[model samples]
Target: MTIAGSDSGGGAGIQADLKTFSALGCYGASVITALTAQNTRTVTMIEPASPAMIAAQMAAVFDDLDIRAVKLGMLGDARAIATVAEGLRGRDLPLVLDPVMVAKSGDTLLPDDAIATLRDLLLPRATLLTPNLPEAARLLDTTPATTEAQMAEQGAALRALGPRAVLMKGGHAAGPVCTDLLVTAAGITRLTAPRLPTRNTHGTGCTLSAAIAAGLARGLDLPEAVALAHGYLQRAIAAADGLRVGSGHGPVHHFHAVWPHV
Candidate 1:
């Protein structure tokens, strides 16, 4: 289940999550929390669906589907977060939270007040929390410097926030190699890949988290699942670099290696 908002551009929010799930060979389901008039260039406007509507959608999905894992992306406000949290109570399922606070175009997807709600309620319930550099900094209330040590330290701090594991993504940092550190009470595992120079990075975070959810649904452990998901996203990004879809920063091709249409 992908509980998030709709991206009209079909890049970043629920759209990207669903594509990633399908690409990884998992049945995808969604419970939309909001809708945004967004493209590769910018988010023009946001229309948050009522909390009751969001809850109803989740209930409907839970009632019908045998959902194994849930990938949560953008929840616009505190109420939306609360609604999802309330709906998820007592379910023993893998919940992957991609703390999508800011978009690639620098728009704030989650409100300031909603951050607290996310930390208080959602983080504790999540099986794994994936946060990029900025999101990790916000969650830890510290500036993340460009260093591997700092990344691991921050990842550890994020893990202490109640999630079973925390993946601190290093894509936002200044570096030649991008590293994502997975921290848990057990230990830290680092997954490194060469950062491809490309503009088609619109849905990277969503794709990574969704891929991890797919892996979890397929019964992989936290460390193994995150490693495979990171590798998959790296190849997807490299293959999608030059394929232009929209005017501005475009999306990574979800079906980069699938097949040519008939």
Candidate 2:
């Protein structure tokens, strides 16, 4: 299940998660917690779905589907987060969480109260928590991470907050190589790739987390899943390097390999 807000632009949030899941050969499902009037350039408005309606959607999915894994995204407010958390209790499934605090256009997706509930309830239940440097700093209530060593340290600190593992993404940091650190109760693993110089990077966090959910549904171990998902996103970005969509940053081509007859 992809629990997220709907992006009318079809580039991020639920749209991106479902596309990534399907491209990775998994059946996709979703429960929208909110709807955004957004595009690559900006989020003009947000209308959060009521908590009751959100719960109903989740119940409908769970009652009918054999959900093996869950990819969680934008929960609009504290009530929505609490509702999702309450509904997910006692389910023995792999939960891949992308701490989606902000949109690519720099709009806040999660409210302050929701962030607290997420750290307390949802983070502990996550099989893997994926957070970019900025989100990690916000979660840990510390200064923004500026170095690889700080990334690793924050990864460890975030792991202590309850998730079984943490994927600390370094894409927002300045570097020749984008390093992603996966820290588990078992050990730490680092995966790096040359940063693709492209504007087609919208929905990257959603794509990565959804890819990890697809990997988990396909029965990969945590480290292996994370490593493969990182590679997948890197390739997608490179393949979309020259493609243009909106006037602002475009989205990574989900069907890059299959389309354009390259």
Candidate 3:
């Protein structure tokens, strides 16, 4: 299940997550914490759901569905964070937390004050914490890592903050190859892929994390899920140019594997 926000443009947030879950052969449930009037070009407005409504949505899903794993994204504020934390407390399920702080268009999705609330309430409960360079830096209150060594260090640091594991994404780093480090207490697994040049990468982060959650829901271990999700995202980015979704940074092709390229 995905507990996140709604993107009216249908490229990121809950929309991308649901698409990824379906593409990876998993049934998805959602609890929307916020809504954004957004497109590929920009986010013009954001409206957060009331805490009661958020909790009600969560209750409805957790009540009936046989949910296996959960992916979290784009939680707007402290209230929403606390609500979700309480809702999932002691559920004993695998939780994938995507620390979504910014959009592809450079818009801020999460405020600075709410970071503390999220770290306090949700970080310790997460089975896997997924964060890009900027989001990681924001969480740690440090500069973004520019080297693999630094990424490993930061990943270890984040894992120490109570998450069982951390996946430090290297997409923001400059290079021809994008490297992601899966940091666990046991060791670090380095995943590298050739960076495809494409601007249609709007929902890459959401898609990757959701795919990992789908794998986890299907009983794959953390390392296996991360590997499959990484490869899937790489292919999606490679096929992104085949789509013409918007004028700005468009979305990755979530159905790239299933849809015939025109």
Candidate 4:
């Protein structure tokens, strides 16, 4: 299940997550914490769901579905974050938390104040916390890492904060190869892939996290899940140009494996 915001553009947030879950052969469920009036170009407006409604949706989903794992994204505000934290506190499932603070178009989705609330309440409970360079810097109150060493350092710092593990994404870093560090208490495993040239890279973060969650749901271990999800996103990004959904940074192809060549 994905606990997130809804993107009307059918790209990032809940839409991308659900698409990823389905494409990866998992039954998808959702609890919307907010709604965004957005397209690939930019986010124009955001309306957070009331705490009651958010809680209700979570309860309803947990009440019936035999959910195995969860992916969290775009919880709009402190209230929504707290509500989600409360709903997930006692659940014994793998939680893939994606710290979604900014959109591909450079719009801020999370406010400055709410970052504290999220770190305090949700960080400790996550099975895997995935944060891009900028989001990681924001969470740690430091500048974004420019090199792999710094990324490993930041990942260690974040792990010390309480999550079981952290996946430090290096998409923001400048290089021909994109490297993602999977940091655990023992050590860090660097996963690298060639950076594909494509402007349609929206929802890349959401899709990766959701794919990892789907792998976990299918009984794969952390390393296995991360590997599969990493490869999946690489292919999705490589195929992203086939889609002409929008004028700006468009979405990665979630159904790259299943859909006929575009």
Best-to-worst order by lDDT is: 3, 4, 2, 1
Clashes of each: 0, 0, 0, 0
Cα misplacement distance, residue 51 of candidate 2 (Å): 0.7
Task: Report RMSD (Å) for each prediction in the order shown.
Answer: 1.4, 1.1, 0.6, 0.7
Clashing pairs in 3: none
Over the stretch 1-262, how does candidate 1's per-residue lDDT look in tens digits?
Answer: 9999999999889999999999899999999988999999999998999999999999999999999999999999999999999999999999999999888888889888889999999999999999999999888777864788998888877777889998888998887888888888888888889988888899999999999999999999878789889988998888775567798788887887684231
Model 1 Cα RMSD, Å? Answer: 1.4
How close is every model to the real structure, measured as TM-score?
Answer: 0.97, 0.97, 0.99, 0.99
Task: Please identify model 2 stretches exceeding 4 Å from their true place.
Answer: 260-262
lDDT of 4 at 186: 73
lDDT of 1: 0.89
Candidate 3 Cα errors over 4 Å, as ranges: none
| lDDT of model 1 at position 32 | 90
Candidate 1 — which residues are off by over 4 angstroms?
260-262
lDDT of 2 at 236: 81
Residue pairs that clash (backbone atoms under 3 angstroms), model 4: none
lDDT of each: 0.89, 0.90, 0.95, 0.94
Q: What is the TM-score of candidate 2?
A: 0.97
